[model samples]
Target: MANIKIITDSTCDLSSAIVKELNIAIVPLYVVFKDVSYRDGVDITAAELYSKVNKLKELPKTSAPSPKDFHEVFKPYIDNGDDILYIGLSSRLSSTIQNAKIAANEFPEGRIKIIDSFNLSTGIGLLVLMAADFVKEGLTLKEIFARIQESLPKVKTSFVINTLEYLHKGGRCSAIQSFVGGMLKIKPIVQVVDGRMILGHKTRGKIEKSLRSLIELTMKDKDRIDLKRIIITHSEADEEAKLLKKGLEEALSPKSIIITSAGCVISSHCGPKTVGIIYLTK
Candidate 1:
């Protein structure tokens, strides 16, 4: 058995099969709509979350898993006498990491190390996958922590909001301004910088162009890329994701490219038709 266990929250946006295949533990977040709460990626799905958003004309609130939720996932590993390394969603975006810390503090001198990924979606997922590699390599917990920390600065995460409606509805931008952007066919790209989301280049006309912009930016440092793998995460943006996958294959020549749909926690904010290209640099 591996000496260390890997855990993450749903905001990682990793596909269920990959998570299960890697034997990674994921504690889900919550998506609440009209007084009803559903566990992200469990009771609720991205399609259901998007359906409610468009149908209700409002954003569903997403909450981090409680301390008890963390305990349930952690206790099993602790009982098995395994060390844990949890890669959490950006604290700037969610309080999932904080709750995990609280739960860890209550354990009997538990051996849990939590790293704030300082990123979102596939951004954090990339880090978790790397940790899984470390475990498979028979690396110690201390070594995995050092390597992940060393890799933090080189991880790049970015996405484009196909429409401004979701951002504006969440008060991230403005509804009126987003309506104007829609009228003008403005698609803005967002990048995670120091754990916060910031606007990047804005594309006009098509989402294909926006996706191209993301690929171009990622390839800006092509020579520095660790093109072993990459992630094309989206919220029902399959066509654009395909375009990105093709582009990455042609441009960066990555070995593995994964496409995963966002769950309720992410779809609650990014809405439908959002796509992000996440990668790591050497």
Candidate 2:
């Protein structure tokens, strides 16, 4: 059997250390600012992207990688006779997976398998980590793929945003909604549902208060949450992310709670001071 290699896009929000340790390959998306495009994670860090946004007072446009970009990432592994298991960004959210499908057509059939995570950030990262473990246990590529599909719906992915301005800029929110929400200091807890982001609920208060509400909401289903690993992803919200990790720790005492910074592609839409909690369920 050919070795199975796991590949995921940069939007997984996994730490560079974790990616290197797991031997996971990442194909980055693009972050475009005023006609200048930089590969997410490769050319622009989230901090730099935020800096640019703050300076220009304009949100950058994010884009999926082209089919050619995916092709290049897939080619070397194909030549090595390894089987590829690519877990990508949600199909409903971006064309990253679709482009990956287009690239797969350039390679021999049966060697490449593309899966839509139907989730983003460390939500996708959780699935990729599971696939990596499956590979370690000597499972076939097909087995890993099947297991990932089974695990998709069990992922609980959600975030609380500090402001709606980014949503308005991205056209996900109406200007009036943004203006009103901003004035009210309304924070929305956006949940991933059926591969699309759905407004879960709204909390009216300071961000810290909203984060506490988010923790309460997440812990409601704690009994069903898989304790193996949990992820806290943030965009320029280190302290807030740490608070989330601490809350989960005190409540669930999960085996692993990883804090990773969201990359440019994710940060571009959610904007600064956004934090999300991601995990798989039992």
Candidate 3:
């Protein structure tokens, strides 16, 4: 049995294959549309959520799992005599991390450790993966925490939102901004900075130019790129994701790049046609 167990929520947006391969435990969040609610990843998948989001007249809403949810997921590992390390979405974006911390406090001392990733989607997933790797390498809990802390500032994420309607709906931006931006066909380039989402730049001309700008921002520090570890996540925008990947490869020529779909929770906030780039820097 492993001495330490790694846990994360569905917001990580990691694939089942990767989770299984890494032997990591994931707790699911909930997505609600009107009176209907479903557990993320368990009751509904990215594909299903995407289809629903596209067809529904109103945008879907999402909620973080409660303390009870984290308690249930953590009990088994604790009962098995294994210490648990739970990583979660950014506190700036969700209360999931706070709930996980509360749940951890309910347990006996030294039994659980909850980490706020200060990131979202594959950005958070990248940090979770790094923690999992450290645990798999037989590192102590303290060592694992230290490594994650060190990598926090080095994790660079940048994205381009195809439309600002969802951002407006979520009250992250004004409706007038969305209206004017949408009319102009402006693509907003955003990034995760200091644990909160911030607008980095706006590309007004064309999609290609916007994409190029995103790639350039991500590859700004060519000397510090961690090529072997990078992730690109998109919300029903495979073509743009692919084009961004190719552009980044040609520019920085990273060691590897893994592309995957962003989950419903993230998609709910960013809306469809959102493309993100995540990388670990030295």
Which candidate ranks first by TM-score, i.e. highest?
Answer: 2
RMSD in angstroms, all models?
A: 1.4, 0.8, 1.6
Q: lDDT (0-100) at residue 210 of candidate 2?
A: 83
lDDT of 3 by residue, 1-282 (tens): 448989999988888888899898988888998879988888987678767866886667788899999999999889889998888899988899989998899889877877788888887789888888787688988788878877888888888998888898778898889899989998898899988999879998667788888887876877888887789998888998899889888887777788988877888788888898899988
- Per-residue alpha-carbon lDDT of candidate 1 for residues 126-199, written as tens digits (9 for 90 to 100): 99999999888888888999899898888898888898888887888877779889999998888999999997
TM-score of every model versus the real structure: 0.96, 0.98, 0.95
Model 1 weakest lDDT span, ten residues long: 105-114
The clash tally of candidate 3 reads 1
Clashes of each: 0, 0, 1
Positional deviation of residue 219's Cα in model 1 after best superposition, in angstroms: 1.6
> Model 2 clash pairs?
none
TM accuracy, model 1: 0.96
Residue 16 CA displacement from its true place in model 2, Å: 0.3
